[model samples]
Target: MNYIASITSQGQLTIPKPIRDKYSLHNRAKAIIKDTGTIIEIRPLPHRDILSLMGILHDNPVVKANRGKPSQQIIDEESAAFEKAITDNVVKEMGLPPRKK
Candidate 1:
């Protein structure tokens, strides 16, 4: 499936209709871009709501170890931890005040 797409002035390229239709990529579909040294790849991500992702890690060994807790709780905790790390990094980089404990 060789398709050519021209990049616009703003560095955006439109995926041709045939490829979009084949991948079910309708309006506002999200695509993940990756660069693997020699090649770049674009992959369409399935549209799913947060609720749809619940229990996705239910059978995982790590999640199973904390069986009593809900999966959403674990997700929330991890999300908070990630956000904190990002905030801390930005604060350090910008010489901002340390975040209150």
Candidate 2:
């Protein structure tokens, strides 16, 4: 289906109700934008929980090398790494000192 939307002066375009409903999109839903030189694509970002991502690294060499370890251990390590990345980014972007743990 082809739909035309006009961008306002503020550079915002409203997603039509029909398109939104078809994609199960709701207010505050996250959308990913991609620019492919020819056209721009917008896609809904699916929500995921930690439980749904468990065991994804089971086949990884590191995980295989360290066999018998619980998946929670890997999850905790990954979570820490993610948190550190966020903290580092905030510190660098805002010129703020690192927080005391």
Candidate 3:
């Protein structure tokens, strides 16, 4: 979908609803704009949670504790929720039905 994004005097571009919805970009979400010579590319920023980076070897007995404690149960759960939300948005944008619980 094509959208007319407005560039502010400060050189900030406000992505339109359709494009944002298509790419699962929400309010205050970060993005990466690239100049590819032939065409410009706009992509959603890499979404990551510091807690999610912990416990890289949660299942490994030796490395589990040394890499720092895993995210608290609450933080882990919230990260999962964030992942699900992004996935759901992508599915919806692709015209696919949501998965059944």
Candidate 4:
């Protein structure tokens, strides 16, 4: 599983095609480069899209659904609170003026 690669004058290295194919790496994939005392290691970033993220957490068994039904008023209040938290986080990240129109 070893191959020779050269570092270019611009400080870029070409990871050989065979190694790339074996590791399922694609163009522009992010990697963590570690410089241990004796060796250099490159690790790929985790898959980040929703489906891949869900797959990582899919092993847990589902529990029985909730049995006690809450009153509609309580449910509406809780839903509104959750939505407000999400909206606030989004706005903070974007740093846009409060929604207009």
Give me the candidate number with maximum lDDT.
Answer: 1
Cα error of candidate 2 at position 8, Å: 1.6
Clashing pairs in 3: none
- Quote each prediction's TM-score: 0.50, 0.47, 0.48, 0.46
- The per-residue C-alpha lDDT of model 2 at residue 3 equals 91
Q: Compose the digit string of candidate 1's lDDT tens values, residues 1-101.
A: 89999999999999999999999999878888999999999999888857789989988997677678887988888899899999999999999999899
Task: Give lDDT tens digits, candidate 4, residues 1-101.
Answer: 67899999999989898877777778867677999989999987755655556655345432122224456756776689799889878987999666552
In order, the Cα lDDT scores of the candidates are: 0.90, 0.85, 0.78, 0.73
Residue-level error in angstroms, candidate 2, position 32: 0.7
Task: Give the range of the ten consecutive residues with the poorest summed lDDT in model 1.
Answer: 62-71
| Best prediction by TM-score | 1
Q: Which digits, one per residue and each the tens of the lDDT, describe model 2 over residues 1-101?
A: 89999999999878999989988778867788999999999998775645679989978997686587788888888799899999899898999887777
The TM-score of candidate 4 is 0.46
| Stretches of candidate 4 exceeding 4 Å from the true structure | 49-101
Which of the predicted structures, 3 or 4, would earn the higher TM-score when compared with the native?
3
Ranking by TM-score: 1, 3, 2, 4
TM-score of candidate 1 against the unseen true structure:
0.50
Q: lDDT: which is higher, 1 or 4? A: 1
lDDT of 3 by residue, 1-101 (tens): 56677789999888887777877888767787899999989889866646668967678864544355555865786688899999999999999999787
